[model samples]
Target chain A: QKEVEQDPGPLSVPEGAIVSLNCTYSNSAFQYFMWYRQYSRKGPELLMYTYSSGNKEDGRFTAQVDKSSKYISLFIRDSQPSDSATYLCAMSAVTGGSYIPTFGRGTSLIVHP
Target chain B: DAGITQSPRHKVTETGTPVTLRCHQTENHRYMYWYRQDPGHGLRLIHYSYGVKDTDKGEVSDGYSVSRSKTEDFLLTLESATSSQTSVYFCAISELLAGGFHEQFFGPGTRLTVL
Candidate 1:
């Protein structure tokens, strides 16, 4: 499939724990859902942004969208160590007029201290 | 970051020579993008622009080539470089606020190395 399915996680929590990241999609007009945060070499940064489905908080980060199970999530409640890095999941759907973004193959967070 | 700025953050060419990567923006967003981050393929969109001689062609636009005359500039060209076109190159800017909420703001990457 691979319209967008993230799980390239190196996931290794410990700081404050409670970190969960996921993504699953097959199109269906992906209405927009993003969460990016890359650090190693730097570049992707926009942490959490939702439009379709519900759930969106911006403190410890929490963005969840479930457009009828297309699924999308990013929660990192108490994590620390500056919240490691690499966690990307982007989606877009405007077609003709323009709006292109479909990326997923990231999820490598390691907040350990 | 947001205001974007990428230019020879680091480069090391060789493959076939000819490489130009520059994306500068001072906001004035009207949509302008060109991404490429390999290692398993995460961010991939090779060109975009919606004004100033408008442009298009993404999804790994074969070998790459883009140029937006003005509008804060956006140019990515690798006429002959290979080595799978090295990686790390991002430049984004979006604006369509209100309801449609399209927000993309990046640029602090450009680490080419085709040898």
Candidate 2:
């Protein structure tokens, strides 16, 4: 099994709808969790970051991590058409003296007007 | 886009040819990474550099090598490209922050097509 698993969803939703994207990981040593948003033909940019098992909110985005279940979630409120992109979840532990992240297959999100 | 630039934004090469991608950063961050993105595989690290002249292999580093001769430049070279090496390549820079957190900033990707 892959270390991280995420649905490659072309999840279509209307503007102003609430969107929930999730990922499940099998590694228990992951202490840092991050969500990245990638636009078409562009590199991904960091959207949200959280440490361990907790929730962190930024604007319309909220990141939640549940270490016990090895699950992580990113919630988007008041989604907009401009928010259409691929969301990728990444986690990392301090291994070999470096924190190299392992990424999940991204979920594509489309918020239409 | 954080003071990072990748050269040859797009390229087409034949299999068995050697291809080199350049990543230049002005941020002077202590760490640099090379990754490739393919369909169904989000992003896989190929190599990373921790300091000048210091480099290490990543998860998928079999056919790849890297060099970091200066603080601001990291280069990834494919000894001999293959059809499987066709993918979008990205370079990211980061500095080790307090609490062992490293928030990476990526450059515009380089699209390489191996025919």
The best candidate in terms of DockQ: 2
User: B12-83, model 1: which lDDT tens digit per residue?
Assistant: 999988999999898677889898888877888888998887998988899889888889998999999999
The candidate scoring highest on lDDT is: 2
Model-by-model DockQ, in order: 0.32, 0.87
Candidate 1: residue B3 Cα off by (Å): 22
Best by TM-score: 2
lDDT of 1 at B1: 64
* Cα lDDT of model 2 by residue, B1-115, tens digit: 7899999899999999999999999978888999999998889999998899989998899999999999999999998999999999999997677887888899999999999
Q: What TM-score does the A-chain of candidate 1 achieve?
A: 0.34
TM-score of predicted chain B, candidate 2: 0.95
Global lDDT scores for all candidate models: 0.87, 0.93
The fnat of each candidate, in order, is 0.77, 0.90
- Categorize the docking of model 1: acceptable
lDDT, candidate 1, A1-113, per-residue tens: 78998988689989998898999998989888999898898888778789889999999989989889999999989899988999999999865587777889798898889
